[model samples]
Target: MRLLLENKQFRIFWIAGVFSDLALITYFTVHGWLALQVSDSAFWVGATSGAGGLSLTMFSVFGGVLVDRFGRRSLVLVGLLIRFVIALALVALIMTENIALWHVLLAAFGEGLAVSFLMPAMMALTLDVAGRGKLLSATAARFAGMTVAGIIAPLAAGSIVNSAGIEWAYVMIALGFSASAGFMLILRPPNPAKRTNSSPLEDLKQGVTYVIRTPQIRMLIAMIFITEAFGWAHESMLPVMARDVLHVGATGLGYLLAAGSAGATVTTVIISNMGDIRNKSNMLVGGCIGFGFFLVLFAWSQWLLLSLAFLAGAYAAVIVYETTINTLLQTSVPDELRGRVLSFQAMMWGVTGLAGFHTGAIASAVGAPVAIAIGGGVVILNSLRIARHRSQLDPDLAQSSLDSESIDSRGDQPES
Candidate 1:
């Protein structure tokens, strides 16, 4: 922790990310709620989120090529500024009583598309500042920071919405993004170690090809997409679940979110203290299985308190699964290809939106609880498939492959 503070670059990078994440969380919290208000349908709410995810997905590869071709700082700045401006516009629309569902969709699309650049640059830049030796610890610290932020953000957002109205929540989102852009403008993060000189289209093709040819990356991505497609719609499902399934109001929804973050925060602190993990693959598998199980439990529980506890445990498992996957990928991937590679990870997030719609449709047909249970079951199936690939990875490679990231100036032994 002291090392994170002592490393000026990591401190600035982490702080900037915290602000951006806070803004994003606040925005989405309000955004989904608003979508529900306007349409009164879970499917529409999911579709609203899907619009943004679609934008992010469509633009991620381009964002990657640009980040690798150009510099990180500039792209990060552009992305932040774009979102800040969108937030401001949203504020205007809300204030003038002119806000509509289309306005929400417009704002979502702009923020989502712009953020594709910011998210990859953020991760790639963190690796640059920390380098390989401190990368895992720094990444753990980063997640811990975000977890802390997540814990506070929902309760705070709930208060603002409860006392001042949802309009004020969007105002907070604007301020948070503005502050993030200001702080980012103060940092001196590194550029990619290897820059692409090819056409953007050709570079994108190569990035795709590279991910395919790398078995570890390929297998990991397959797992991620499966989880994403079946498992990642919980946020979109939250408002409906809170209102219909649990009879919890907005404030109750906020408490549930905070409870989940509390669990994630505890797990992150544990990981940060552990330093280099030896049984990371096992932890990753266990995390997925735990997450899936808890989600099913949460779905089945009728009592709000019990459901909240299960939800908290579910998020804790997700944090463990996600943090491990990120550390492994970042440590193992080449600095040159890092931007492009991380972009694919961003695409996993994009997949979540489409999955959100699928779940929402199910909820519309039946109910949110059943949809959530089905999603969890699907995740467990995918986890089993991910486990199957482990046998082919060689026990030594499975255990110590983290060291491969440091082998050369390139990175992670390039698949085969």
Candidate 2:
């Protein structure tokens, strides 16, 4: 609250996130609905979503290198502009009635490529705009902004798809992307780390090595990968649950999605207000467990109201864990490594996408409920594994990794 009110640059950045995330959220909602409409198969729906994830996996590391060399602001601007173009293309396709599964798959892949650059830069820029001391609040506030988008985007996109047509929904997405880019045009965060003479490949190698060797980062990345693969993968099956299981249409799906966003909005706002706190690891683990538990409940739910309640709980728990991890990772690393380290985090979305594809196939084989429940179960077991290895989450271990084999000129091993 104070941060947004006090920092002009961060305020602009936050506003841009709202519109950018709105575009993203709307695109996903509409994409799932459109995929279902065109193919009428769960496997194809997951494939479409997975295509984007594949793009993210392939290009995100490069995006990180670009961010370090070029600048975060420029990448963010370019990414949003690319998404705006993609949205326009989708609009044209839908309007011409030439929409097909391949078109959706291609669009999702393109969108993911753009986001690969946009997200790492955006998150790295947040630390610069708000300063290290305020990373948690800034991140939580940013999530809150996205939650606002989440609450509005689904309902609005759903209504547009139901009433005016899918083309109009895409028009809204394009406009949102453009609007976000416009807000970004005015933002001037601090410059990225001083460009070293090191080649981009060298920079990338250093970043990956740093994450691999640093115990906290290594473990955190692994933890998030598991969470994304198993827990978040359930997202692709959401439409299946909404339509086949819940027997709901587009409008009903909108409410179902919006319910989760509403829950996230509340959670993010509260976290934004709380400021940074200690024992973040405990909170992170607890949130992960809660997210899995709620997701399982949501999967098994037969009643719409019960499903909404569980979904909301799942989203709320996700916000806590996700925000905490973002804060932890941002605060743990130096400014120069920020973009690269965060890039690995962004790559997790790719895992989520690919995992969603598998989850969808599983859903087809067993059932949506069973598939989702299985994913949720995996998350529970993974988080429990982390809970037992508490020392891996310690910030001291990250500091030790940084200080010992510093990426500095000396490369001297600092004494423990």
Candidate 3:
């Protein structure tokens, strides 16, 4: 905490992250409810959510290019500003009672695009502020912030939507985004590496090539893609299950989702206090396997209490795995290439998540239980494959594969 407080840029960045994430979570919770109200069809709700993921998947590579070319701070500032404007437009549409399904879809897509850029830039900037020596703690702090927002937003949005209206919830999110953008505008971090003259496209290509050639990064990326595609589909399907299957209302669904967030928050806080753990590869593999198991249990649960418990456990495992993998990547990759690589990572997640969203829609049609069960099975199988190939998947292998220019020339050498 002291280390975090010592870095002015990092403090600013954390504040920005909190605000942006709060807005995002609030939007997602309220949007899901609004879609259900308007369409009265689970399939459409899934598709409405899927649309945003689809947009993010399509534009993530470009988001990476923008971050690498224009710089992390610039990309974040631009993305947040765009989000603020988009949010205001949404407010106008809602106030005029002129909103349609297409307008909602457009707003979701725009938010998705902003996220595609903002995520990678934020990761890169966090690394820049933390430096190599403190990467683990920094990553933990970022995840902790996200967990806090995730936990708070759903309950808050639910209350607002139930009492005031969905539009008020959206208005709250817009204000959050506006405040985040303001903080970002004032943030200026010292550049630790010299700038390059290469085009953004070239830089993006280089980043992708670097990941593809590195066995560890490639394996990790593959794992995340599979985990997101299969293990995390529950999020996309939860609302449908709560309403159609469990006979739960919006408030009940909010509480169910909040249970998972609470678990994730607890995990983040615990990890943050523990400092860095060794054998990060083991942590990644074990956490993912745990995540898959809990997902299976959650899918099969008939009792609400059982379902909530399983969801909470699964979410906590995901938080552990995600935070560990991100720290590994930050510590393993070169500072110069961090922006592009993080962007590529974000892109892979977006694409995989998009696939998951569609899969959820298909699953909802067939029966939520069967779909979730199949997804959980796939997650277990994929995680086992990664564990078996740990040697190839470990980020430490990047030490040998990365070219000189792939990392910052002056950054710390690989620890012997």
Candidate 4:
């Protein structure tokens, strides 16, 4: 904790990140509920959610390039500024009672675009500030913040919506975004490394090639894509499922979502306290399998109590896998290359989520249970295959390779 306090920039960044994320969660939860109220169709709600994913899929590559070229601080400021303007526009529209479904869709898409840039830039900044020795702690701190926001934002938004109106929820989110922008404006991060003449396209290609050539990173990325496509996609459908199948209202769904957040918070605290444990590779493998198993349990559950329990378990497993994989990436990759690599990872996640949303939509047409069950089964099968190849997929391989390269560099020098 003292170490974290020493990094003022990181604290500022964390504040900005948390507030922005709070706004985002509040907006999306309320927006989805409002869309359901307006159209009374699950398909449109899914499409609204998919629009955000599609924006991330399309723009993430460019966002990464901007981060590498212009530096993390500048890109973050720009992204937050854009979000501020977007939020203000949304607020104005709501205040005048002139909002429409298309208006909400456009706002969601714009926010998604901002996120494509903001996420990679923030990640790059975290690595720069925390450096190698504290990467795990830094990651744990960020995840803890997110978990807390996830718990608070949805429930708060639900209460506001129930008591006042959806417009009030939008106003609250706008205030959060505006405050986030203010905090971001005060942060001044370290300067990025200078580049000679590298084109953005070449940089993107290089990042992609590196990930492809790195066996562990490749396998990890593949696992994330597949796991998120199946197990994670169910998140967008939760509101609909709660309403239609479980016969629960918005507030109940919010409580269920909070349960997942509580689970994530607990796991993050455990990881933070444990520090770096041995057998991380084996732990990752086991966590992935556990994630899939709990997802299956969540899908098959009919009782609300059982579903919440399964979701909590699933959430914990995913958080562990995510934090471990991200720590490995940040510690292993060189500073100059971090932004581009993270961007690629973000892109993969976005595209997979887009596919998963469409799959969920199709499943809704048949039945929500059928869709979630199939998704869970596929994830379990894929995780099993990955577990069997644990030796090759171990994320520690990257760190070991970096150490070996350092040794080789030292050996090639003349005697002092």
Best prediction by lDDT:
2
Structural similarity to truth (TM-score) of each candidate = 0.93, 0.94, 0.90, 0.89
Q: What overall lDDT goes with each candidate model?
A: 0.81, 0.88, 0.77, 0.76
Deviating ranges (above 4 Å) for candidate 1: 191-194, 391-396, 399-416
Cα lDDT tens digits for candidate 4, 1-416: 34457789888878888898788778767777876776677777777677777888888878877777776777777777777777778668867888788886777678778888888888887777766777777787888888888899888988887788778887878788778878878887665645638888998888888888987777877887787777777776777777887777787677777778888888887776666664466666667777778877877677898888888888888888878778766665767777877887677667644754676577557866667767777777887887777656554654676688999999999997
Q: Best-fitting candidate, measured by TM-score?
A: 2
Worst lDDT run of 10 residues, candidate 2, spans 396-405
Better of 2 and 3 by lDDT: 2
Q: What are the clashing pairs of model 2?
A: none
- Give the clashing pairs for model 4: none
Better of 2 and 4 by lDDT: 2
Q: Across residues 338-413, which tens digit of lDDT does each residue of candidate 3 receive?
A: 7767776787666654654566667756877777777788888887888767646554443333544466654667
Question: Residues 36-108, candidate 1, lDDT per residue (tens digit)?
Answer: 8777889988888888888888988888887788878778889888988888887788778888989877777
lDDT of 4: 0.76
Model 4 residue 290 CA deviation (Å) reads 2.3
Candidate 4 minimal-lDDT segment of 10 residues: 390-399
User: Candidate 4 regions off by >4 Å?
Assistant: 1-3, 191-196, 395-416
- For 295-382, candidate 2 gives per-residue lDDT tens digits of 9999999899999899999999999999999998988888788888888988998988888688888988988899899989999999
